[model samples]
Target chain A: MPLWDALSNAMRMTRKRRIGPDQAERLLATGHDPAHPELDRLLAAATAPPRPHELAGLDAALAAFEEAGRTRRPAPARQRWRVLRPLAAAAATAAVLVGGVAVAAEIGYLPGTDRPAAHEQLGSRAAPPSTAESGHGTASAPAGTVEPTHSLPVTPGGTAIERLCRGWDDRRHKGRPMKPDDLRELAAAAGGEDRIAAFCAPRLRPPGNGQAPPNSPPSATHPSPTLADDGDDDDQGEDGDEQAAARNKKKKKEDE
Target chain B: MDDEELAGALADAVRGDSAAFASLWRAQQPALLRYLRVIVGESAEDVASETWLQTARALRGFTGTPTGFRVWLFTIARNRAIDERRKARRRPEEPRDLTERELPGSHPDVANEVIQRSETDWALSVIATLPKDQAEAVTLRVVAGLDVAQTAQVLGKRPGAVRIAAMRGLRRLAEHDEVRARRAESMPPIDLQSPRTEGV
Candidate 1:
């Protein structure tokens, strides 16, 4: 039994050591071994030429290939459009937001331009007392413009004088009677009610004579003469007035 | 196919040229079918067809050399074969007897073709008798003509393990009873230096 076990162990070791990676590579590559012709035959049989049944599915495979090509050809372009759609929408939204803020700032609708609200209120009061008392067209204009004045120091004296001049000119042109409240404010500003026309004569000249028309309504572009003279009252207000004046000058040049 | 021919065909195929794709199919289908025969048995043709369809769908996105393409192709076939086996296991139908399987022949020289086909079938049947890893390693290395590293990539095994499996598989084929009987018949009757004398 001991001798038989030794023989079997030796045989197993020899079998294990005989075939390795290098020998397998050689046998697979050349297949011309004189010592192992059976292995050569086995390899030859395994790698025989293609049988007829192997290529039978060519038509089906090609059809599938053509189908895949047809379906996938337009995918990249559609994918690109899909990826860019959101970016385009975001760009358009950003443009609208920026443009809206700029228009609001130009029209004195934004915060920190509290002087426009004060002027707007005085202009409402300076309308003909019958129109102002009735609470019609000019009364509603300053309602949206009144919220910002509470945060600012009151400076309605100059704006009131400009509004009275505009109201007096408008009444004279329309051949309408003057409102008593407006006449009282004009009397105070001109030192008397009879001198109201003289006080407004130089102030109401048509634009382009270094004096804008007082017949024109009080808007962001037309700062009251007293406000321009008393510039130290509000620095931001003066800057806004100057910018509006510069823009108007440029617009006038373009129009000419 | 050679590298240059394969590169050109792959480029044109990616551009949706049917003729170039057909060339690629012709070059790869034989080895793919033989490998599938070893792995999936009678369903080799079906699995190969599925593999080609999948390859066609993903061909545009595949970027690699010819060798890499071969590796990718075999990887797809292996995955499909695994799926087929899983499906077969779930169904659990009666296994087909190997002796009853028919060998197809379309050539005019009928007798010679039958003999050769039977030999090929016999060899493949013997290989199929090996353990799964050994059988796959041998089929990929010898029949599909892939290098050890490429076979490892397809089989998802280490190169050393694939090499060892292939070596053992070949050794087992060499030591099979039928192979030894055939070797004895082909040898001179009075030979004394036979290696079998020591082991047997």
Candidate 2:
């Protein structure tokens, strides 16, 4: 059942050992091989007890987990690579893009792109941008508009088609085409209005402060524009020059 | 190593010193391997590896002398041996080859004439039929070099149990030997390979 009673002494060595004079002679006989002592010695060694040297796997497993922690932090480039790669790039890009997407899917958006997306994000004050979007050209969400680099309160959208369909319109309470000045104000408020078209490819929402879109510089931090008083800007092209001047000043500072 | 030395080595190892760990392993492996051979029987090498794996995991906590190390190491080994036994116990038992058919000495070490002269073959055939626990106990005590207490610790039993088990095991072996001796007397002892004496 064990191996054979010949090994009984071997077993007994680890348990209770009692070898009579005659019994000892027999074990000697059974272990008649030249290496019996060596083999027995080794077995004796094994039976002595396990020490720290024997527990390699558990130590290795713990070390491996620690090493893994070092390699797991998400990088910003990895995030963009994930989304842009699959949607706009090749299969290799897709693989990289997918990784970031998986990561971003849970954490909200990619890091650098976070600010712009938040700026374009509507009434959801939960979005964190404007403060974060300064020099960034990209918005995390496809919907918001890019503001002039100098201004703030930029509206955002994914595409012109999508943009036109967003928000309740004044005429029919349904979505309608946005005015040119509205785009200008958004350009100024967001920062670098020239990039508005590229940004418009994604659907975007209007700035919360009732400005002329991303085209104007912010006169105030908070958008306290009551809808009745602020809608007047929707009817005019008068604020265009003022915003353009502000954008020119921003460009000059950038060039310096 | 002595307790202080072993503890110092363990301290070094826990501090991420590979050399300390290596020294510990080297110092402990020989004895550990010997015990494993008796416990795992034929799969000594494999069980030795498992034992090392276990030791590696717990090495950080070790702070004992070489003697204490042996006890600690054997404690783990004894548990493993029991586990192996449990596994084997679950399997269907193989029918034993108990028939008294002694083959002529065929090992290269034995001369053809001495092989013909000795009772080696008959002895081997009979011993091969012994039960596993008895065989293991006999092998470790006779061959592995563990004292009664250490052996008991390795087998995860009281020293008394180890003594009893060893006693019974060796007694049975004596019975087998007597049976073989009678058989040998009837057949005549040929001059085979000289019987090898087991180590003390």
Candidate 3:
């Protein structure tokens, strides 16, 4: 048995242990263990009442509480609106303005506007022959001359100029003499004068019947959009170009 | 204050009586500071301040006796201490003073200073030498005057675990060389005096 237990038993026999829970707590806090003087010193030292300076934080803590109480409701609500208001406005503007223009362009309502006219001006500067003969070829064909037809089945959005270039390239491939006029038109159909090589190199490949590709800008300058819808028309246009070139070839052979 | 008076003050505080709230703070803050000192060292004061500010904000929604209030306040203090420790680790700033670096665990050598400051500071330093969980268990048990059940609630540990930790911590303190030497010089631990100690 420990010495403290022997001593505690002696005390219990002599006097009643009437200490309440609070007294027991006080004894523990004060480090009053009979068997351990070192623990007593340590606990008493550790649990001593804090001095005045230690409680200095009370005022500051209370002030912080008061400040938080004052700002709790209004600050976060106002801040939320401050952040979200501009974002909402910007989203609305993008949805209404940019989306409207794109929608108008898709339905062809924009072609009659100054944007397409500006594009035509740039196209004319790229190749001057097209500008000179533009009204004659676009309006009506001269006697025995092939008329430039906008009704010719093409990838939608392909201009009459691009189709004419494609037709001319087809004919040249079938043993017909390549025309200087046709070369000039190809340059105009390309967006810039420097782009003629890049533009014609891909589109002039002989079409596989009804295999019109998606309108990828670099894979061919021609807008081969709407393959399923325009496949039959593309086949018909290819056949017509081939037949025209075959006739021209036969005529040249006979003349020789 | 008795339990009735404490419950009255708490009710008044919940109703926005700052004076009543201050009374509660005065009663509880000392023990809270001691507990935080063991866990957070020199930053205990700052953490205690944060804890009170949070307690003040949430007091209206708080529904319990003064004992419950202590548990809640200490819980907040422990969480704030954890956050401070995490922030300190991420920053790794140079210590502002050599004393703070040497504090909490290292026993001060100046005999006069140790005697004078033993009231709270020296005791905290000794307790801080214990393992983190043991230190927390001892401080929450002895300093905060929480029962085993309440200390377990604050530490999120089982009652038996808290009791074991506190017992181990006390045993370790008893076994310390400094404490054992002091025990040799001092009189026996039993006090035959009446149980009318101040602040009990």
Candidate 4:
């Protein structure tokens, strides 16, 4: 028997015989079942003053939440408002779009549709051939028209006029938004005098409103706003002069 | 509840399920409070509250067995005790708060009451005087009732370290008790309960 058995056993009954920390720890860890006097103490200790009680504050917190539920008052309405808030905004936005499109159609603003003359006034439809038929079939080409001297540097086999025409033409062909820089470069290279190119610009009359693009002069001649221009549209149609104003407005807005 | 059901509840609690959390509080609060009482001494209530707050904060997905749950709870209690000790050290020494925590195995019969009470109280008081390693070992083995391995798990100390602590703690208690008894015997009994008659 171990020398400490009597003391250990007595300690055990009084709850002090559990194995000391080291041995129990070793036994627990290594599976080496060492004797535990202290563990005995612990078990004995466990049996002390045996009564259970509720926590001090648990009842209070439960009551607060309960009362909040009973009142049907503060948080739910606030939460409901919060939850429905985004829903309400979405509904309003839908209403505006449906109502807005109807209002716009009433004013004959729907594209390419037959409308009353009063509402169609702002449309940029191609003009009738009579406007350009001022006798240009054989003689629209003046004595100066055949001269290539007015053209700027174009690639080999490509004339300046052809290059100039490609700038606006490519924009339309590509269906890309024409940056102001493109118009400026084209205008600068084409070197002034041909106001026709400026007039054919699509911005002459905005679809939604009759407002013209801002900061844009009546003609492309007033210092091209952009530094880079790709000459695409070769010839400005007869209504080009009228359309230039609207084109400039849209272009200016694009720049902004 | 079966282990699975209990594990599920604990897992849910860990996952922030308030109902599961309430269940845990209901199930473990009593034993936990008692453990807290002994561990933190006087301010067991404070320590217990702090323990709950911390447990609530750190709760995550744990599927613990009953033993594991007790270990977890006691680990929390142990940490709070350490914090309390640190806080107390920052102030002056005060009398221990006797919160009458009921230990499951600590009570003795009337015949043994005087001796056991004196021994246990003396053990508890002297426990703090032991080397820290020894004190922890002794507390786990003697007070907390953890086996050596479980105590080792709680403490992260080697089993050897724990054994040394208990041995040292026991020796210290024996020494302290001997000294007290000797002192008591040498001195004349000063009985305050009896009338303080004038010196004859």
Alpha-carbon local distance difference test for all models: 0.65, 0.42, 0.57, 0.45
Give per-residue CA lDDT, model 4, range A92-180, as digits (tens): 44645556544533342334232233212222121112223444766554676432222222122112222334455556557765557
**Which scores greater on DockQ, model 1 or model 4?**
1
Model 2, A95-138: lDDT tens digits are 35446444542342333332345324432332235534553556
Estimate TM-scores for all models.
0.56, 0.33, 0.49, 0.37
lDDT of 4 at A182: 49
Which scores better on TM-score, 3 or 4? 3
Chain A of candidate 1 compared with the true chain A, TM-score:
0.27
Give a tens-digit lDDT track for model 1, residues A1-256: 9999898667654533466566788765554344345676667777777667566789988998998787675455335434654564454356455565445423423343222333334433333333334556645546554422222322355454566777887897788978987776565454344445655554454322355544675663233333344332232221333343343334332110
- Better candidate number, 1 or 2, judged by lDDT: 1
Residue B165 alpha-carbon offset, candidate 4, angstroms: 2.2
Which segments of candidate 3 are over 4 A away from where they belong? A1-30, A71-256, B93-116, B185-200
Which fraction of the native contacts appears in each prediction?
0.45, 0.06, 0.31, 0.06
Clashing pairs in 1: none
TM-score of 2: 0.33
- Residues B122-192, candidate 3: write the lDDT tens digits: 56777888987778877887777777787777776667766667766776776677776766677443322
Model 2 misplaced regions, further than 4 Å: A1-256, B1-16, B88-136, B175-200
Please estimate how well model 2 matches the true structure, expressed as its whole-model Cα lDDT: 0.42
**For candidate 3, lDDT tens digit of each residue in A81-137?**
346545644543554555554454334233323223332332223233333365555
